[model samples]
Target: MIKKFVFTISIPIVLFGCSVTTTPNGKQVDMLPLISDKNRYLIVDDKNLSKAEKLENYSNQLSEFYGKQNSAYIRVLPRPSYQTNDRFTPIPFMVYEIDSNPVKIFENTMFNPNNVRITEYAQHDLRIPIGKHDLIIVNGLGNSRWFTKIDDVNFEKDKKYVIGADVKKGQNAQIFIAEYEIDNRFKVVEPEHFIIKKKIIENIPIGNLKSVKVY
Candidate 1:
């Protein structure tokens, strides 16, 4: 039989000094207003900087804590086809973390583009401890897979970070990255919904600068 478990974490007084608000996925929360006057000048709209800031905040919160936590969300898109007249498909997604590895995370069991649909997707959110690790995502059909490494990462208390996936090669394949907010309180907020659209530029042969990453 499949087993299920539920875990709860209480916010501590020291970490609850500031008021916190929650927003739905894809909704942008204003960070400028949350910072103090002295630090407000440092705020800018650089996407990469914003991501790094959130990651740092999250890392600090969970570095000293115990127990694991998670949030769940889904991404829906029309499956891609390598040839005309191919059938539509589904892509299931999830975001999860294990206690033993701090830097590495995983999104297990995804479906490719040609077979993806809203009903075919599922997700789970989990929180665990920090350590070194490996990240892997296996296609449910067992025909394809992706792997990566997560070095030293401290998932902070209440901050969130975004993870993204990209699949440039092979037909009907896709990659997904999810975002999260790790708060000072050491809790995780589900990430926003972002789609990785495919740009079907004609395949260029050797020595094409633009297609180097794709090759």
Candidate 2:
């Protein structure tokens, strides 16, 4: 009886000690670089500096980093792809890759939570090196089985750009990219939308970048 009790206890202990293997079998990918450090300068300002002077200083910083003609800022909007009646509604997109390099967006499982505000999860912005860049976007629906590729996007210097996608049910999604000039107040002004000439992918499976499950 003593041996049986010890054996039963050991079985549970062994099971508890065993680690569960989480094969990257989900759409959740690696985290993207947050805007905390990059955008911190936007909020913190000198008490004596005028708004125009501050903007000029920021512009100088951009010139120092990537030269005056080769730097641009881009912010990817957290716009919805499609809405479903399921638990996860209003599914937003994640940038999978840019210029053939993985964006590795930090996955936030919540479908745009209202009460819980995480700054990293809220913004998908990045300071991209200017020039032609290929972009790949994916959604966190159906385990990231959908994707779209935008190629050869030429980014010019001293411009602030915004990009977003809108998906229609059973149809191709439209990608909207707009450029704006920065004003003396450091605000984006003079909006201009770029016409997309690249082929718009409706949705496709992530074959190479996918995760497999193991039971």
Candidate 3:
């Protein structure tokens, strides 16, 4: 009888000892409220999101958090075709400064949360032309799923903006929204719409060199 009791008690302890994985299937990503760090800025225009299902199978709460056809979580379900020929691992977000020589803002991609990158890069303020620029998102499998050219984007100093991706038609395309506001010093500015972690905002660097030019 004592042996039976001991065996039953041990089961619970063994289960508790197991490590919990924060990432789902090694491909899920927790969406950030401000895709860019506080110092860097970009605003996504308001648009009717192309309604379709994407992350429903993964998380219902996260799907509702986005308030549309997107999720607070993203799963990178990469296909073999996308990895063909050893392509640079597909990043879900990319920005290019429009100029005589368009420069890819690699640092921004490095700093943002991604499934492919192991550790995030040290983030700093972005210095772009502050005019028209191309913001692109390629999901898992290296597919260019969303691309838009936004004009007159205001990336002024000392302000933070919230960017969210709207994946539609089963992840065929995406429309991102950027809502602008004054920096609140790590406070949640728009909780009614979404909640952003204070830690993520403060991690933004108030620095020189502007690692990401928000062109």
Candidate 4:
């Protein structure tokens, strides 16, 4: 079973000095492009660009990278749509670790239903190496902070997957990790439901930390 916990503590800023490399197969580059400008995968955060324009840029970029047969595309949609009561508020989340390695320091963007291109936001598509990876996700709900893990995910190359959540008032959030078949345009056209693997819900915690270092 996937375990979860919540704690109220100040998040500390910790510097992680490590080298992240990208190969021609689009492994590390697609996963953490924000680590450096040399990685062409970095999204150009032009505030002047309309939401549609930003999405178009991402679409075009994804289409161009479709030939990378060694990499898999994954998008995390914790707040896929507007909530009934919290329409404008952000559901902050962070991918703290991947395959036992600490994710390099990065900024988390507010959930914007309009801007579809992958930002540090919860709804962006990320390219990652094809293999079994253990992931840790930290998310916020109201005044509490919680975390969960997706372990032993065997991602295949050239496939697209979406990890989304179903949250309700006075209920624990249910998360689904679904795989999809993409078209020539790199858009998710059909849902391969059988490809989905794990399903879990949030749980309450019994302890708190003075401070947490997520980076």
Candidate 5:
């Protein structure tokens, strides 16, 4: 009968293609349901309006307020003719919070160790909080002159914090203080002779307490 109706229509097409569902090293599993109502109308509806939807709903409410807690400060200025130049020359800076992810923080020897020899103009400070950081400055061995500062700091938890300062370039400028640890988990524990090459600055709006100074 036509080979019994071609083996009964190929046995329900081989049992509906073997009713898929494998694993144990067989690999063939796709439960599929990754948000699909036409991709949920591409989000953004904050009650709906115009003007680009109230500017993307105030930019997602300032990206959830810096994505939660934020703070940063890194100021390093050394250019009294490179303070004798011998190597160390880093200048990378960053800050973020407005929506998280953009934290390389700062660089410039963390405010010291660039041949430690300053001759005047002085300022050093490294108070970091809010998240993501890395600052390095070094060229120390002879002439030095490093300065940095970012005000509005008031952090104390188990004490032990040094913002920034390292000088030795000319007229009686002797300052070297670059130690840290003000709670919120900022890093860069000493030892550096110029090696800053990681940077990421995005969103950034921690209530506009934005202070990013680099040189």
Candidate 6:
């Protein structure tokens, strides 16, 4: 099961000693990327990681007694009216999370409806609860939306996963799931990066997303 509570952290910018940049899509980037050995995969106390760093480690955090660790992202292929020539562009879809309780992972319609392109697509991924279970999903939008349940999805804490789907134009639109796991190195990106230039005079409240250190 994923952690049940939401974390409301007040980041006072000056804590992270690095410069921050934002992508056109509004994702954060660490100008001075953390230069770790890249071979070390260790987890420290929650207190050790700044709110931003902790959020960055959310997907890959290792533990014997924590929530199931799993991350998944969906891709969609566009349609060119009635043509066999696949219009491999971006299509908006929603990602619905269903366990005991049902929830849509993101408010961004593009991310949920699982949008993507052939040339560039990564930033849009849902870091799901880890463990051995099924990932129940619902894709598409408006009246064309439908349910898709992937059974026995073994989500290992160490191994990352990527799921791709092709949207076929039919009576409506149909999604052909899991075309490939493009990267065993499933796109683990820093969702946000902040560089603290100086200590803030007061506690600051920010929004959008948490700091992502690595991937």
* C-alpha lDDT values of all predictions: 0.29, 0.44, 0.29, 0.45, 0.30, 0.32
Report the C-alpha lDDT of model 3 over 25-125, residue by residue, as the tens digit.
24221122213332122212422211111111112322222234411222222222333235554333333222212222222233333212211110111
Instruction: Score candidate 2 by TM-score against the native.
Output: 0.41
Q: After superposition, how far is residue 28 of candidate 2 from its true place, in Å?
A: 17
Q: What is the C-alpha lDDT profile of model 5 across 1-215, one tens digit per residue?
A: 99999999999876554343343445332111111233212234343344343333322332333443443434333343334333453221211211222222111234343212221111123334433333222222222212221222343332223322333466433223232333224223222422333222222222122112121
Clashes of each: 42, 2, 2, 0, 22, 12
CA lDDT, candidate 6, residue 20: 55
Root-mean-square deviation of candidate 4? 12.9
Tens-place lDDT per residue, model 2, 1-215, is 99999998898766544323222444343322212333222333444444344434433443344444656765545333231235454334444566555533222234533211222222324556788777665444433344555667777665656555556788655665556333344222111223334322323433334332211
Residue 38 alpha-carbon offset, candidate 4, angstroms: 16
lDDT of 6: 0.32
Give candidate 2 misplaced runs (Cα > 4 Å): 1-69, 79-91, 105-122, 167-170, 180-215
The candidate 5 region of ten consecutive residues with least summed lDDT is: 114-123
| RMSD value for candidate 3 | 20.1
Which of candidates 3 and 5 reaches a greater lDDT? Answer: 5
Q: Which window of 10 residues has the lowest lDDT sum in candidate 1?
A: 206-215
Candidate 1 displacement at residue 162 in angstroms = 3.9
Q: Which of the two, 1 or 6, has more TM-score? A: 6
TM-score of each: 0.27, 0.41, 0.29, 0.43, 0.19, 0.32
Candidate 3 Cα errors over 4 Å, as ranges: 1-90, 99-101, 104-125, 129-140, 143-147, 168-172, 180-215
Error of 4 at 165 (Å): 2.2
